[model samples]
Every structure is written in structure tokens, then in C-alpha cells.
Target: MYQYDGFDQEFVRQRSAQFRDQVKRRLSGALSEAEFKPLRLMNGVYLELHAYLLRVAIPYGTLSSQQLKRLAMIGRKWDRGYGHFTTRQNIQFNWPKLEDIPDMLDSLAEVEMHAIQTSGACIRNVTADQFSGVAKDEIEDPRPWAEIIRQWSSLHPEFTFLPRKFKVSITGSSEDRAAIKVHDIGLALKKNDHGDIGFEVMVGGGQGRTPMLAQTIRDFLPKSEILPYLEAIMRVYNQFGRRDNKYKARIKILVHETGIEKLRSLVEAEYEALRASFIDLPQAEVSRIQNFFTAPPYQNLEDQEALLNQQAQQNTGFGQWLQANRTGHKQPGYAVVTISLKPIGGIPGDISSDQMDYVADLSERYGFGEIRVTHEQNLVLPDIRQDQLFDLYQDLVSQGLATANAGLISDIISCPGMDYCALATARSIPIAQALSRRFEDITSQQNIGPLKIKISGCINACGHHHVGHIGILGLERKGEEHYQLSLGGHAGFEASIGKIVGPSFKEHQIVDAVETVVQTYLDLRTEDEIFLDTYRRLGDTPFKEALYAAA
Candidate 1:
């Protein structure tokens, strides 16, 4: 993990001091609510349904055990006893008092974390794949580039206020686990035929009221030119992106209205002019940032396959967990383990202070002293030794953190809908909870196989509902909550937006509707086909017919 230098540390501390004075003035009636709105948003504070919400950035979803403990302590001291991990790889404290937030910011600064750029219409937190350096199929780690972008974009005077919020993601593997295609700017690191590394840059991908996949603005950009090229893209968007309507302000809308070809020409012209400017980062600076992400020391050990196999044979529970929650690691004798935050009928990403403390302890004890937050709303111990799996699993089970459902139907991604969000229309947590209970049987879930169910409370797409294998959107209709279902959506390579099946259902009928959709896939799928593949081959006819016929 990247430790904060003196510059970074001092920067955060000064920001905290500034915000503390602002908060004091607001409390003393020197600043009205309207006057304080933008100031509070710049510091990542939001007025939610019942109380203020504070979102803290977890850069590229990387956290040290020490940082994790501080977060747990802050949650315990200031607000409720738990915090919600969000889809953007950030954490939200939903019940903080207005007067206590400055203290929270100071506490976070002590741990090298902050709430800046988490809200308002500026560049948000830069996210990358959770399995970045450790995944077996990785080409290179993307976190270095993400960190470079983070340094460049933080409160840049030129882009302090854009037409709408922008997002950027990077991935270094052939498999796109970061959902790069759905971001405002997506970078896939690749090597050319000459064996030199560069980036495949895509722009204008987002999901809200309008869903669109990013288009390839540049087939290949040299690694040295990433920052300058990004500046060019931003310049183009700022000049042409809509400012009259918030609904049409995202870059995705601009790309749609202007067409990809014309947009590419405009961006290319800007890039040519900016190629000789100071925005082009030097290679030495890039290497300086890359040094922070070098691999941790590892002991040479043989693969623990024999011991793992024996343990699985001895315990059925261990066998199920190995099947569902474990993934292959780049190094032999090591494994990546996903700690399921979504226990059956539990909130998708809520972790209590006690649980966070325990996970932090285990990270130091059993694995490297590092933790990762996934876009799927789960925590990861990224470098667990295979020989110590049994002991870790035992302790995790004791803490109510061991649910052997990582990619199954029970591992749902849901937003804080009407329960906490002021912009939501319906309750997303209950719908997700009901669906989890409906599929609680382990055997049935394994049978269904590799399904993603993403639910959003409204059309803001905070839950990433547009990319799930089975997407559910909750809408308000005539004073009642109605749910709509969509199919064939996915977030990996060749990302596609889901298509709606038909009419909306009442709240009580959604679980059954999802079951019908799953059953239809099971009936129509060929050998070893997943839900998305089956839907693509057969189209929506079968699932739609089954859903409507039963209704």
C-alpha cells in the first residue's frame, strides 16, 4: 500500500483545519444552509434522509490493517456502530451528527484517508480492480497509474467544477473485473507488438438515466502520454458537455449527442496541441510512484495442495467455502479469499466495528497486513497462505464473516435506497434480503451457478444495476413501490447493458419473478453455460415469456 509522504499528510491536515473552521461558523449561524451546501459537499458530507452522511475515500480500494482499525474506531466513536461499503469502493457513515464531522475528518487524516472528491460534480475517486497485482492473469498492476491520476486530479484548479461528476478506472488484465467499460474514462493496460506497454483508452461510458458503454477513443496511447491525453479528453468535454440540464450533463450524454467519430476528431486535435505541454508527465515521476506498489516479501514454500485437500475432505463446510469463495493466486502456495459481507438476509456491505477490528487482526496474523474492498461489496484478504486457510476460515466463521457465497445469487450488490438515500424511490435492501433468503439453499445456489443480481433503489444506478446478469430497478408508481427486471447484462470483457424484460412487479412479487427468470435460463442453457451466455444465445424471448406467463 502507498504510504502518505509529508506533502500528502500536511495537505490533508490543512484541509481538515479549514473544514473545521467552516463547520464552526455554520454552527454559530455565520453560514446559512444554502451557503454551506457546496462547502460541505466539497468535503464529502451529504444531507441524507434522516441525518448527515460522510463518505471516505479508500484509494483504489487498498487499505492497511492500521487504516482499517482507525475506520472501525471512528465508526464506533462518532456515529452508529457500523458503516456501509459502497459500490464505488468507498465507505459511508450514514448517521453522523453535523457537528461531529470535522473531528471525523481529523481522525481520518491521521490514517492517510480523507473525504475529499467523494461527492459534488468533480472527478470522484479513481477505482481499480481489487485483484490488481495478485491475479494470475494480470499484465501489470494498475494502481500506480491510478495513484498518478489521483495526484493530478485532486483539486486541480482547471477542473474543480465540471458539468457533472467524472469517474476513471484502470485494469491490467484481459478480464475486466474493474468494470472499466462503464466509467467516464476507462484504461486497459496492454503491450503492443513491439513489446512496449501502453494503454487502450475508452471514454464516455456511464449508467444513470441513460446507459452507454464507453467507445475507444484511442487504440493505443504510450504510457508516458496518459496524463496529457486525459487532459485533452477533459478539455474537449468541458468545452462541449451540456451545462443547461443536469440530466444531460454526463460525458456519456455528450458522446451520444455528438457521435463517437466527431468526438474522436475533437479529442485528437486537443491531444496534438497539448502533446508538448507540461501536463505530459515525466518518466522518472512515473517510476517514483511505481516503486510504492512493489510486491511484499514472501517466503519460499511448496504448494499446500495436499493439506488443503485433506481439510476439504474432513469438513463439508470447508469444501463449500473453497468452491465458492476462494480464487487462484499468482504465486504458488497462496490464495485470494473473499470475505462475504452479504450474509443471508443481511445488508449487502454493512460491517460492524467489532467485525472490522477482527478482520484487521486476521490480516496481520494470517496474511499480509493488507485488506481490499471489492466493487461487488465484499472484503478481501488478498494474500492468504494456502496452508493457513483452515485456521483463518475457523476464525472468520466465529465472527459471522464467513459466508461461502462469493459469486452466487446470494452475493447481491444493492444500494442504500429509500432507507438512507434522499434520491431513492423504493427500498433496495429489503428486495435484496428477500432474494437472498429465497435462494438460501447452498445446493440450489451452486446449481444455479455464477449469477450476479444487482439492485438499485432508483435510476441513479448506484447499485450498478445496469451491469448485473439479472438487473433489478426499483421505481415509484402511484404511491407504491414497483420493481422492474432486466437480463443479459454483465461487467466483464465485452460489457453490455441489460435489457428490460417487461412490466414492473409489486414489491412482494419480485423474488418469484427472479426465480422464474433463473429457471428459464436453467431450462434453456446448454452444458456448462452461465446465465448471460444462455440469454445471449436464446435472446429474451424465453425468459420474458416465462415471467409474463406466470404473472
Candidate 2:
């Protein structure tokens, strides 16, 4: 992880001091609540339902062991004994006193972390694949670029107060674990014919009251022009994006309203005119940032295929876990391990302070002394030794983190919903819980194959329901909670927005509807076809027909 430089240290210090004074003024009655609301929001403090929620950005979801320990300490000393990991790969504190926010910021700054840009209508945390550095298919680690964006967008005078919030996600892998297609700006790293690494920029993708897949603004942009290109896109949106109506404000809306070709032209015009004037990013600066993420050294250990096979023969549970949680790594013998936070009936991404400390310790003991938060709302011990997999698995099991459902149907990604969110219309956690409980059988879940069941309390799509294989959007109908199902949405290499199947279902019927879809897929799939493949091949006709069938 990147250590904070002098400039970084000073910036955070000054900001914290300024915010401390701001808090004092607000408490002393000099700054009224009305005047203080925006200031607090800009500092990443929000007056959420029931209490104040402070969202702290874990940039690119990479954190050092010390940082993790600091988080554990924060959770232990303050508000709640746990923190909620969000789909954007950030962490949130559900209960923080309003008066103590400045002190909280100071503590975060001690670890080179902060709440800046985690809230309000500005560029939010830059997210990326959880296994950015270790993914076997990655052309290059995306964190250096993500860090650059963090510094560039931090308190940017031009964009700090935009019409609406903006989010950017990047991925260096071919598999697209970062869900780049569903973000305001998505960057996919690629190598052209000449074998030079760069990015394929996707613009105008988002999910909210309206959802639209991003379109390629540039098929390939050289590494040097990334910042300039991003500036161009932001400039275009800030100038012309709708401000009169909040619903029509995202870059996605503007792209749809003006047509992608026109939007592309406008961004290009901005790029051409402003590229020269933009600050020249130093190569050494990028290299300095890259130094923080250089791959760790590993001994040339022999592959453990035979040992793993023997263990699998001895324990079916271990075999199931290996199949679900283990992922290929670029190194010869290490594996990327996803510790599922979504245990049956447990909160989607809430990890207790003790669990956080344990995870941090485990990362140092078995994996690298580093951790990552995925867009799916899971944590990753990205550089685990292959030989120690079983021990690590056992440790995780003790904490109920060993769910063995990484990409399986039971491992659903859901938001806080009506339980904690002020904007929610229905309860998402209970629905997620019911569905996961229904699919508790690992064999059945694996038999059903790779399925993403994402749920959101509202159209904001915080849970990324718009891209799930089976998307569930909760809504209220006539004072009763209901869920509308969407089928065939994908957030992989071939990204597509999920479409609503038909009418919404009652809260009780929603889980049944999901089961119906799964059973329908099991029957309809030809052979080894996942839910997504089957849905795309046959379209929604079969599934929709099956879903609405009388029980």
C-alpha cells in the first residue's frame, strides 16, 4: 500500500484542522445546521436515518495492516463495534456522534485514510477490482491510476460541487470483477496490437432512478492521457449535464438525451482544447505511487495440486470451499482468497471490530499483510500461500466468514435498505437473507452455477441490482413492500443492464420468485450453462413465463 508523502500528510492535517473549527462553530451556534449541512457532507459526514453515518473511503480497496488495525480501533472506541463495507469497496460507520466527526477524521488521517469524497455531490471513492495486483489476467495493476484520480479529484475546485455525485470504477482484469460498466466512468485496462498497456474508457454508465450501460468513448487511450481524458469528460458533464432535475443529472442521462456520438464529440472537443493546458503529470510521480503496490516476493514453491486433490478427497466441505473461494493468481503457487462477509442471515458487509483485527492478523500470518474490498461487498486476502489454504480456511470458518459461496447464488450482494438507509422504500436485508437461506445447500447452489443475485432498496442501485443475473429491486406498493425482478443482467466482459421482468411481487413472494427462476434455469439450461448464459441465449421469454407461473 502507498505510504503518505509529506504533501499528503500536510493536506490531510490542514483539512482536519479546518473541519475541527467548522464543527466547533456548528456546536457553538455560530454556524446553523442549515449552513453546516453542506460542510459536514463535504467532509464525508451524513445525517442518516437514526444517527450520523460516516463513510470513509478505502481508495482502490487497498489498505495496509496498520490501517486495518486502526479501523478496528476506531470501531472499538467509537459508535458501533462494527463497520459496514459498501459495494463501492468503502467502509461506513452507522453510528457516529455529530460532535466527534472531526476527531474521527484526525484518527483516519493518522493512517493516511479519510472520509473525504465518500459522500456528497462530488467525485466519490475510485473503486477497482479487489485483486488488482494479483489477478492472473491483469495487464497491469490499476491502483496507481486510481490513486492518481484520488489526488486529482480531492477537493478539486472545479468539480467539488457538481450538480450530482459521480462515481468512477476501474479494472485491469479481463474478467471485469470491478463492475466498471455500471459506474459513471469505467476504465478497462488492455494491451493493443503493439503490446502497450493503456485503457478502454467507457463513459456514461450508472444505475439510479435510471440505469444505462456505459459506451466506449475511446477504444484505447494511452496511459499518459488518462487524466486529461477524464478531465475532458468531467468538464463536458459539468457544463451541460442537467442541474434543474436531480433525476436527469448523471452523465448517463446526458449521453442518452444527446446520443453517444454527440457526447463523444463534445468530450473530444474539450479534450483537444484543454489537453495542452492540463498539468503535465510527472513520470517519477507515477512511479513513486507504483512503488507502493509492487508485487511482493514469493519463494519458488512447487505447485500443490496433488496435496489439494488429496485434501479434497478427505473433506467434501474443503473441496467445496476451494472451488468457490479460491481464484487463480499471477504467481506460481499463491491464490486470491475471498472471505465472504455474507454469511446466512448475517449483515451483508458488516464485520465486527474483533473480526477486522482477526482479518488483519490473518493477512499478515497467511496471506500478504494487505487487504482488499471488492465491488461485490467482500474482502480479499489476495496473496495467500497455496500450502496454507486449509489453515486459513479454518480460521475464517471460526468467524463465520467461510461461506464457500463467492460467485454462487447464495452469496448475494445487497445494500442496507430500509433498515438503515433514509432513501430506501423497502427492506433489502431480509429479502437477501430469505434468498440465501433458501439456497443454503452448497451443492444445489453450485449445481445452479455462477449467479449474481443483487438487491437494492430503491432505484439508486446501491446494491448493483441492475447487473445481477437475477436482480431484485425493492419498492413499496400501496403501503406494502414489493420486489420487482429483473433477469439476464451481466457485469462481466460482456456488460448489459438488467431489464425488469414484469410486475413486482409481494415481500413474501419475492424469494419464491427467485427460487422459481433458479429452478426454471436448472430445467431449461442445456448443459453446464450458467444462469446468465441461459438467460441471454433464450432471452427473458422462458424465465419470465416461468417466474409468473401460478404456484
Q: Which ten residues in a row have the lowest lDDT in candidate 2?
A: 542-551
The whole-model lDDT of each prediction reads 0.92, 0.89
Residue 333 in model 2: shift from native, Å?
A: 1.1
Off by over 4 Å in 2: none
lDDT of 1 by residue, 389-431 (tens): 9999999999999899999999999999999999999999999
| Model 2 per-residue lDDT tens digits across residues 243-281 | 999999988999899998999999999999997799968
Model 2 clash pairs are: none
| lDDT at position 292, candidate 1 | 90
